[model samples]
Target: MAGTLQFDLVSPERRLASVVASEVQIPGADGDLTAMEGHAPTITTLRPGVLKVVSTEGAKSYVVTGGFAEISATSVSVLAERAVPVEELNATLMDQLIADASEATAVAVDKDAADKAMADLVAMRAAAGF
Candidate 1:
């Protein structure tokens, strides 16, 4: 078996996950990356996408709007602006998320990031069909 690392994900609402995982797939602002045991220490901003955690127990996924990930050799910590388990996402929930993003985009001073985030949320909704 591959080496494991501690992984934790949290948002303002609650703590979503705390587990030991073989790997974690992150949706980085620049691109996608994977973190694993013995990985180099780094931090990156997260984009809107599914965050997948593969562990001894099984695979779990969460939808994150925006966030920061701190990856160290021993652990990966994610602090998200908003997050929801993939299983809990539905059309109603997705609609609200998109609407919220839209509102935020309209008022944002920096259009680049808001535009990118809005685009990603749309893509995520399309990909998930919700």
Candidate 2:
């Protein structure tokens, strides 16, 4: 792995991925963060969004909702609450979720729930190129 970074994605249910790649893009709470082989050692909270993994092989996208990311000199480890491939995402379901979350927000019951729903919607939209 001379020029590549080792990346792993784990969830409560299972270990989703382990890859050696040249770059990785994560959806951090603040924004998107890209990592390479010599990235500084750091830890950050992942927002509900898509994690893009890129390499000479190809590119893969995963929807990750809430997680912690650890970046080091040689590796990046992500422990996610939930994760699924972009292709499997259901837009209709997400649209319904957005509507329900908006209703919740309007009622002022759970703002956090609204935020998470918005994040998920944003991630899905981005993943779908819309």
TM-score of each: 0.89, 0.75
Residue pairs clashing in model 2 are none
* lDDT tens digits, residue span 11-88, model 2: 998887898988889988667899998899989987666799986668988877667999998999999877777776
- List all candidate RMSDs to the true structure: 1.7, 4.1
Model 1: lowest-lDDT 10 consecutive positions = 108-117
* Candidate 1: tens digits of C-alpha lDDT, residues 14-119: 9999999999999888788999999999999997778999998899999898789999998999999899999999999998888888987898777887888888
How much does candidate 2 score in TM-score? 0.75
The model with the greatest lDDT is 1
Error of 2 at 62 (Å): 0.5
Q: Give the winner by TM-score.
A: 1
Candidate 1: give the clashing pairs.
none
